[model samples]
Each structure stands twice: as structure tokens, then as C-alpha cells.
Target: MREFMVELTTAVPEGTDPAEVDRRRAAEAVRAGELAEQGRLFRLWRPVGEVRSVGIWRADDESDLRSNVLGSLPLWPWMTAAVTPLQPHPNDPGPTG
Candidate 1:
């Protein structure tokens, strides 16, 4: 498997309905949890006061991560994502103890 750091910048159009934005955000959170349970998403964080987010992801390859993971994001249409592949570190904790 490969690990990647994905940075996301959200862009909710100014005229979009607030209720729809809220709905999409809530749905996005639910989908994120599902990805976590599937082992595709490892960690997620939001930058302080920024319209951006970061997530650590695992997949067989970049294509898999893009198609199966990123592609399935609920808020994908309103977000721009940059992905960087990560290398395993010797001192890093393994998947399990």
C-alpha cells in the first residue's frame, strides 16, 4: 500500500444556498468516517481559521486513492485537492502494536 498526504481547499460558491452547503458538509463528514473505517483515510485535520483541510490516506496506488477515495468525496465538486505520496519512516508506529 502507499500513503499520501492530501491537502484540500474548499470553495463554496457565494450564491450557493446555505442549507445546501450545510447538508453537503454534514454528508462529507459521514463519508469521511466511512473512509476511515475502510482504512483509506488514516487521519484528518483542519488548518486554523483556514478554508483548508489535510488528510493522510492509504491506497494501493495513486489511481486507487483518486478513484475510490477522492472521487467518492461528497464535497469533491466544491474542493480542490493536492496529493503528496508519503514514505514510511523507521520510527513511525506501524498499523498496529
Candidate 2:
């Protein structure tokens, strides 16, 4: 598996119903949990006062990450993501280190 740093920014379109937004957000949470359980999603964080998130994710490759993992998100239609492939550095301490 390859790891990536993903930054996601969400923008709900104007005139969208609040209830619909709430529903999708709920679904998105559930999907995120599933990914985490599958060991594909490592960590997620939201910046202060921003409707954006940064996370660490894993997949077979960028194609798999985009077509399967990210495309499955409920809020994908409203989200814009930037993905950066991660590489281990010799001096860096890993997860267990």
C-alpha cells in the first residue's frame, strides 16, 4: 500500500437544503469510519474555523485511492481534494517509533 496526505475542502452549493447537507454529512461520517476500520484511513483533522480537513490515507496506488476510496464519499460532489503521495525518510520515526 502507498500512503498519501489528502487535503479536502468542502463547499456546499447555494440554495441547497440544510437537511440534505446534514444527511450527507452523516453518511460521510459513516463512510469515513468504514475506511478507518479497513485500515485505509489513518488520521483526520480539521483546521480551526475552516470547512476543510487534512488526513492520511492508504491504497494500492493513486488510481485506487481516487476511483475507489475517495469516490465513495457521500460528500465527494461538494468536496475538492488535493492528494500528495508520501515517502518514508530515513530519519523519520514511523507510526510505532
Each model's lDDT: 0.91, 0.95
RMSD value for candidate 1: 2.0
lDDT of each residue in 19-88, candidate 1, tens digit only: 9999999999899999999999999998898879998999999999888899898888888989999998
**C-alpha RMSD by candidate, in order:** 2.0, 1.3
Instruction: Tell how far residue 71 is off in model 2, in angstroms.
Output: 0.6
- Could you tell me the TM-score of candidate 1? 0.87
Q: Which predicted model would earn the best lDDT?
A: 2
Over 1-97, each residue of candidate 2 has an lDDT whose tens digit, in order, gives 9999999999999999999999999999999999999999999999999889999999999999988999899999998999999999999776773
- TM-score per model over all chains: 0.87, 0.94
Q: Give the worst 10-residue stretch by lDDT in candidate 1.
A: 88-97
Off by over 4 Å in 1: 91-97
Specify the highest-TM-score model's number.
2
Reference-based lDDT, residue 77, model 1: 89
